[model samples]
Target: MSALRAPASPGTRPAAAPRRAPLTSLPGGAADRGRRLDAVRAPLQATSGVPFLVLCAVILAGALLAALLLNTSMARGSYEASRLQAEVGHVAQDVQSHQEKLRAAEASLAERATRLGMVPAEDPTMISIEKRAKVGVGEADAGADATLGP
Candidate 1:
């Protein structure tokens, strides 16, 4: 209220306060100076810091976006690694199957040879080059020459 306002007096002004009387050419009346001060300090406004807050929000949003992208990329890499592992498993199974087939073929080798009328030799002999004749060999059976090449 106007009644409760501080009265215009030298007592109200601080002892250390400097005056702008020469520069501003203020009026000599104490009432005018008091009113001028009240007008200067009336309904004072300050910065709302909207720009700083907006910048901080933008930075935070950018960080969150980067994190989301990073997470998505890592998940994609994980899925790719899993897929490659599955492929390796399949390839391993294929290799195992091939090894099994080779083992089966090796196991049937002797049986196949018997079916083809091939037999293991009871005695192994060789021709002597110096003597120009067979050596350490018994006489052959009558049909032996038919199966053995000359």
Candidate 2:
């Protein structure tokens, strides 16, 4: 005769109990218990116009800046173009006046030469006013080139 008791195993360990979370760690704790938290956030969730409004505001600001820059650049370009045009006009007038003066001087010289009876000789002579003499020549032949027909 023996007591009917089961043998205990020496290699097994006891099971661990389930741990509870700390009471103070609940979200918002006791302060969020009043009213409906979901209802407070309903307006934000239902509204779809906020993002569109923000996007429009950004685009409008960008357009305004672009317009301002374009206006400034156009004004500057116009000023430079007008200034250059005025300078060109002034230069053209100066050139015309110089051309008239040159024509008048040529006319005056021709008239003076005619009044002095300096006739156009059949054989015209050329005299060199340079300090150097002709190289490799016994006599300086001046009118040799002029004798050739134009």
Candidate 3:
């Protein structure tokens, strides 16, 4: 059987349009120069996703670095606080030791007074004077006189 070609209708269309040369291929003109300049600046004009991602990455990195620095500063402060607490504890221990030594010294002074023939009086005498009084104004007792050395 012979293959028959179909007749073209009045409104039939071609398979494809004719290819034309780009505008830049033509002679130099304002429009062509503009197109050339646009071509040159197109890459710069159209933003790429990489720059956005890079900006986000930079911001994230900066935030992380700031957090790290803040945490480091806080850790240093904690360390300093711990050191100060330890120092306070050591100072408190020293104060306690000094207080104990003072108590011992006071006891030793009391013992030394007793050894030096000083007796603690059971009844303490108080003589109040509004103005200066003459020496030996208080009444003398035999026990007081006996306590004094001859």
Clashing residue pairs for model 3: none
- Model 3 bad stretches (over 4 Å): 1-44, 114-150
For 1-150, candidate 3 gives per-residue lDDT tens digits of 258867778899757988997755556765765653543344657666998899999999999999999999999999999999999999999999999999999979978999999998664444335433233433544235322222
Tens digit per residue, CA lDDT, model 2, 37-128: 44334464576798999999999999999999999999999999999999999999999999999999987986799999987655444534
Backbone clashes in model 2, listed as residue pairs: none
Best of the candidates, lDDT: 1
| lDDT assessment of candidate 2 | 0.73
Return the clash pairs for model 1, or none: none
- Candidates 2 and 3, the one with greater lDDT: 3
Per-residue lDDT of model 1, residues 63-147, tens digit only = 9999999999999999999999999999999999999999999999999999999997777666677666555564564324322
- Candidate 1 Cα misplacement greater than 4 A, ranges: 1-48, 113-150
Error of 3 at 31 (Å): 24
